[model samples]
Target: GFLSGRQENVLRDLRRQMTQAAEELRFERAARLRDQIMAVEQVLERQKVISARMVDQDVIAFVREDGSAAVQMFYIRGGKLIGQNHFVLEGAGEDADACEAVQEFVKQYYQTAAEIPQEVLLPCDIAEASIVQAWLRSRRGSKVEITVPVRGDKRRLVEMAQENALHALEQMRAEMRARLSNADRALRELAEALRLPEPPRRIECYDISNFQSEAFVGSMVVCENGEMAKSEYRRFRIRMHQDHPDDPRMIREVVSRRLSAGLEGEARFTKMPDLILVDGGQGQVSAAAAALDELGLAIPVCGLAKRFELLILPDEPEPVALPRNSQALYLVQRIRDEAHRFANAYRILLQGKKQTRSALLEVPGIGPTRARALIRKFGSVARMREATLEELAECPGMNRKAAEALYQYFRDAEVREEA
Candidate 1:
């Protein structure tokens, strides 16, 4: 009774410590303490006053579902459960021998573990039971026994472990199936809204970003089967009509370049999208359609207007208004937002490069060649600002005097900004 009371007190203290650890945001420490608390609780639950003898033991049970197997171990000390652990085995054959698997697990587990119990209980008898028992006895410095309980408290414990393993496997399978089902439903809804023959497995969205007529860039974001495919995304630096950059011209150039790459069988752009969405109103839709027409392609193109969240199609007389809560509309909005973000990111990168180049050129001694070298070496203006004078001097095409000038320029700029 004293031992049981002491164990309860330790469990209560561990629970309090775990709670405090979680409150302080020490998650790793909290997790370890939580495990200790669980082990203590399990031991208390398995306590049996009928068995006066205090003996340490382990009960192991095995269950298989599909091609996966779960082996659960319940650790008992002084006739009380101390803890439990489970191992999941993938590609374990459906008709594999459970006894042999359990035997192998026991051998491997006991080899590394410091503690070896006086007894081990299994649902089925292991082949080398005596040999394992001897090995365990040698480690424990006392006699060890291994048995398969027929119908007793030990057998009931084994059954419970097996049930737990099966339940865990079922939960995993349910979660996986639910994800696939949701993806399928979303794709179906998208297809029905767009009036396509089937779901658009590969969808691409485009957006253009620029400041006045400078640093014009377009981004193409890909989504396959209701999921964003970041690897397939492409960015283009608008080349045509650079002097007068407009949304229609930028959309046209991006779409044409992308279609040409696909036609030329570029590995990344070889797969044509089932649908193309442009981030604009009617003008963008018409521009994209004309680009595809020039290439003799018949891909479906639509435009999404941000103001009223309207969908504009090339052939439709008016824009289509989707339900506010529709899944299809949500998917379209996500794609459009991602495209805008990607394009804006490219624009910012180019603007930063321009500013860095201008700043370098403003310094009296640095010209185009030295400015390009510095930009290449430093990667960005922020990095150049943080660089030491010695590092700047060590860069190619830079000497002590030039390095000091470059460093002083950034320092002065910082002071000016602060002022």
Candidate 2:
């Protein structure tokens, strides 16, 4: 969402790449490049020209507080707002000098920058203006001008960037805010951190619960604008590996079923989420990615491991440990936790419901203790029904006769229902 590049420049490069891919008969690569072009065009269409100078420049602003500063940079090419980004500089003096921080960024950034702008706009004059400008010019092989706009549209752009920097600083240092506007900011931060095409307006998080390999279930929790959309919450009864729970395979099944149903025009599955999060690490991410690949859906998928709260992205070697207090971390944790909660709740309900327990008690020699043991061993009434007599008899406190009786009860019930 931030510092991506000048949209037109990106779009031009993407179009060229797309054409090349097509000529090479790499249809998948061409399709991906086409998607990138469309995403950039969507962003470009919403741009508001911040300047009329028709020149390349970098607009810089900063917010300094508590010995730290956040610097926001706007990359303007041909007077259009191409891209923007923010940088956090800690270890500032108690005075929290923004100009010093901004100057430091310029010195370090331009050292290896691929492209240098003709002009650099700053909110205030740095200590060595002439020297810095001379160094920038040397790097650019042309004259570079540094200007501090006093008033007009240029000044307003600085103010806007400064405001954004303040927000960025606040998010990094504090707990997540509940306000809708703040949620919007958190979404933007997440998009930037994850390098998504844009901030996700609708996010779906999936989690699996198979405690003791009993009552396996999958949960799908939705967050719209960073708030839980309870109405959209869904639970899936994992149809495979009831006796032997395979979490990764189950995850693939859940995601595949959900997306396939949506594509099939089911009202409940319609309105696909912009992003998908699975509660796990690489295994879960890979499983979900495999499902998406099979379905030919290019939706972004990630995993959140509970142990370190690390974000595991597809094709990324290492997991991302977000800043402890960042909004992106908070937003992701919120969705992950909700999905876990929903999944566990469904599992608990399936295992503990009195109806299911009572049904077990009806079997010959199945007392309260035996019923509880069977539920723990087999997971649910559904699993018990699917169990073989030998498997049931192997359970604690269950005899062969009791297992036979239990099996017969299920069969007789099925027969009566059929009749």
Candidate 3:
């Protein structure tokens, strides 16, 4: 998808490797390579097949506007030629439309092609079969064909095609092995970059969001194998105290409460993550560390500082800078962003509720008890307005007179201020 020269370079390398595999008698590898090439060709051929079928013709060839010629023929989905019988003949005379005839031919042809058995057909043409058989015979001829009539270049071509298929198969297997190895290597590099105790199997990150202790909330997100473990995530509402607004205390309380509750709860944090990350500098890390220490959890903790692209280690004087393109860095960014997103959403929800509560609670007659009763009964002030006086009186400590007064007060108040 880059420069044409780069694309050409890659194609040349692939061709060279394919040729080398074939020469080395690595039939399985060569077959795999051939299959890839065939699959790619099949994808390109989809347009041809679709257009040809729609046009109702056996497309012999087409020249693109760039003057590139492409030949088309019917084939089984498995890449085998469907044979000449696939074509149908139509039109009776000189004006007998050849194009219509070709189209008619292809329609019937494809139907038959779909019914072909999933095996190599015995090449009835001896010339074609013989060419392939001879080439196989040169190597292990007797082991090659059991059904086909064995000839000249056609026979050799068959043998070559078989060889290519076998090589492609081997290449596919080798490619898989190499891919697994590269993945392992990349994982190890990430582990080293993060100074993780081991290649992180799972990680948990925490972030706090608030507007000056109003609507304060914390969010925790989990990642497994460098991907989001959203199902395992948790969120917390800040309830301790608003005066100090200490983040360290907030984080500690969140972790402590979450872990403590997880001990016996359904949504338990029983599976400890390999690492822990906080979306702040050292102070957040220190808070998390203390909480984990108290809990006797030994997971390593670190921080992703917002100011710089540095990973803050516990008790370290300087944070470590990881390469911008590093997978390790990406993983940390994912965790931090997820935590921040969750925390921000939770905070917003709290803010919305707080604003609603402040407006209702500011009513002269509505103290905390009455406001809580109204919220609990009607869920919100808007809902309370829709309620009948009887429903309002149903609320604890709310008499009919008070309920009517409240309803009237709300109706008359203009620009009710939020807390």
lDDT of 1: 0.84
- lDDT, residue 15, candidate 3: 69
What is the alpha-carbon lDDT of model 3 when measured against the actual structure?
A: 0.61
Quality of model 2 by C-alpha lDDT: 0.84
Model 1 C-alpha lDDT per residue in residues 190-305, reported as the tens digit of each score = 77777889988899999999987789899999988877789999999999765666899889999999999999998888999999999999999999999999999999999999
Q: List the residue pairs that clash in candidate 1.
A: 43-81
TM-score of each: 0.59, 0.45, 0.51
Which 10 successive residues of model 3 have the least lDDT summed? Answer: 61-70
List clash counts for every candidate, in order.
1, 0, 31
Runs of candidate 2 with Cα error greater than 4 angstroms are: 1-178, 354-419
Q: Which ten residues in a row have the lowest lDDT in candidate 1?
A: 19-28
In terms of TM-score, how similar is model 1 to the real structure?
A: 0.59
Who is ahead in lDDT, 2 or 3? 2
How do the residues 1-419 of candidate 2 rate in per-residue lDDT, one tens digit apiece? Answer: 33766656777788888765544334456668866775675477338676789889888997886666778888888888877777877676567566787788889888998889999989998998999999999988998999999998889988888998888778555422324655687789888878898999999999999777678999999999877899999999998775877889999999999999999999999989899999998998999999999999999889999899998999999887888777777778878888999999999898776567887777777889988898888878888889888999899988888888888998898899899
Worst 10 residues of 2 by lDDT: 172-181
